[model samples]
Target: MILKTKITLALALMVSPVMSSFATTFTKEFERSDGIHKVKIDIYEESNADTKNSKITASEYVKDKKVWSLVDYVNKCPLDINMALIKDSFEIKKINGSFDAVLFSYTIGCVGGLDPVTVKYFAYENGMKHSLRGEERMVTPDGVIDDNVKPVPDANLKNNVLLFKYMTSNWNKASTVILE
Candidate 1:
């Protein structure tokens, strides 16, 4: 019995490292200015007792030197931002002449009995970040003309624009924003 127990303990120790290696993590890289400037997004899943949570971090490197990070930008937000609620999932909508447009969606707490998912548009250009505002729509549409439509990134530098669709406070209308 003593020998058997020792063998079982040894096997468990050997398998522990192999199992932990399967933890979820994802990374993506983008480059501009002929690969002189680079941006990397790293997503890491957190192990928690009650809920599954993940963090998305972005870093910018210029010629192998770290320049900026997403954390820095979030810290400067005007409101008391909850970094934990920011989803790990993000879309790199477009890479324009010297900018990369990114979309991050997060759920805002109930305000006036309405909880809305706000989609924010940000652009990284010339080693700086800028927020792109949605153009005011003249008339509100009746219903969702389309659902879950993915925007295609334009490769032409001349057409330096980022286009994406997002949901508004009302479920009936979906709005599209163009960032240039």
Candidate 2:
């Protein structure tokens, strides 16, 4: 029994690092520029041996400086680290006359097809960052229901406010929400 235990421990130590790397894989990186600011985006895929599902993460940087690291944001938001933002799903737009007042929008892909897509907005005003509110609506074959479902799709900026429009599951109806 002692010999068996020693062998098990030895094997576990050897496999742990390899398993960890497999659990979270760094996939790719891309860059986006809006004339003034340059954003670098990185994509990662996280999985677990205990579960069959995996999640994707998007990390953003500006001018080679980290602006919104998904890992850090997830930790601060207390969101599931595995629920990652989709790649190339972010946009930065000027909100008002002041360039400092900018709006950032991104989307998080769900694990299943039926799961509602999550779109998040961030406001940068006077060098401060704030998370705007979110809204959702349900779509049905018969009609659109304002079942308090958070809207999906990308976010748009109008008069310094963030807005989103999403269609129901069946694409039969559409709804819009203003995030303040």
Candidate 3:
């Protein structure tokens, strides 16, 4: 009985790390006011609870009512590596002259500067929320990691037009899109 107990304990110790599950949740709240529009933003982050993945969700509330929400998966890593959102990189900005268009960004993964950062542009028009642009970029030792979307030369919010520069990626010279 003593030998059998020792063997069982050894096996348990060997499998403990592989069977371990760590879970965590984090939340952040802020308010943004542009003119007469008041928006309350809450960012919720959850790490590998029972879902086996980390995710970040941004909920927008107007007049204490939930209006819109966005989510990004931070993904899961090996036992030695953990993935989570970089709270410091999360930001929301008014991109247009009107209060309709807004931009938000968040960085995911363990490495600070080496992780992929995502930027999303949203517009609320005619009492509805619409996604205008969403892209991710990261610079690593090898090269630049980015979505296929062309880089904007200038965020021309004055006229609500964006000029995309693609030459840097050896694509088209330029292209224009109406952000509004």
Candidate 4:
């Protein structure tokens, strides 16, 4: 389809080799505190020059103690590519006035009609630092970047309700998410 081809071309244009090395490793940290609950998060990313693959890992600590760790994601790009972490995307949100939560968002891109560098949000809760949306889950679906939908704060909205809107050159579509 025309839409698929356009997306492929857009993603291809975004590919860039960030570093020149046999293997590159980097870490980014973010910390949040509310006087009582303190949380620290570190994101580690490594890329291989030969295989053009990258792996991202995340560790979460609550009250200075490790609570959870995970392989956030892996990308196997056939060509040289870079997955840039959105540094300012880290945020803390209060869920239903109950507990504070953390959100980490990033973007990745590759060629051949993929998701096209869409923003991915991984959320974690307090205490045990368990995932608010489950392990390695993204708040947005494939092709749903920041521009596709607008988040509106509604007092009546249920905790489980997720509304998604798909915007394109041709038409706009809206739907509710049925989590798998």
Compare the candidates by TM-score and give the number of the best one.
4
Candidate 3 Cα deviation (angstroms), residue 73: 3.0
lDDT of each: 0.40, 0.39, 0.40, 0.42
Candidate 4 residue-wise lDDT at 99? 51
From the highest lDDT down, the ranking of the candidates is 4, 3, 1, 2
Give a tens-digit lDDT track for model 3, residues 1-180. 999999999998776644334444444344446223343334333334233345555555566666666666544543223233333323343334344433333334443343344443333332344432334544456665665674333233223432111122211111121122
lDDT (Cα) of model 3: 0.40
Quantify how close model 3 is to the true structure by its C-alpha RMSD in Å.
9.5
88-138: candidate 2 lDDT, tens digit per residue? 324454445345333334444433333344445544443345443343333
Given candidate 2, what's the lDDT at residue 71?
32
Give lDDT: candidate 4, residue 133: 20
Pick out the ten consecutive residues of candidate 2 with the lowest summed lDDT: 164-173
Every model: Cα RMSD to truth:
11.7, 9.0, 9.5, 14.9
Error of 2 at 120 (Å): 2.0
User: In model 4, where do residues sit more than 4 Å from their true spots?
Assistant: 1-49, 112-115, 127-180
Clashing pairs in 4: none
User: Model 3, 40: alpha-carbon shift in Å?
Assistant: 7.7
Per-candidate TM equals 0.39, 0.41, 0.41, 0.44
| Predicted structure 1: lDDT | 0.40
Candidate 1: give the clashing pairs: none
How does residue 27 of candidate 3 score in lDDT?
Answer: 42
**Model 2, runs deviating above 4 Å:** 1-36, 52-89, 100-113, 125-127, 135-142, 149-180
- Tens digits of per-residue lDDT, candidate 4, 55-171, equal 556665545676556565445666644354455445566653565555554544454442334334455555433222211113354433333443332232223232111111101
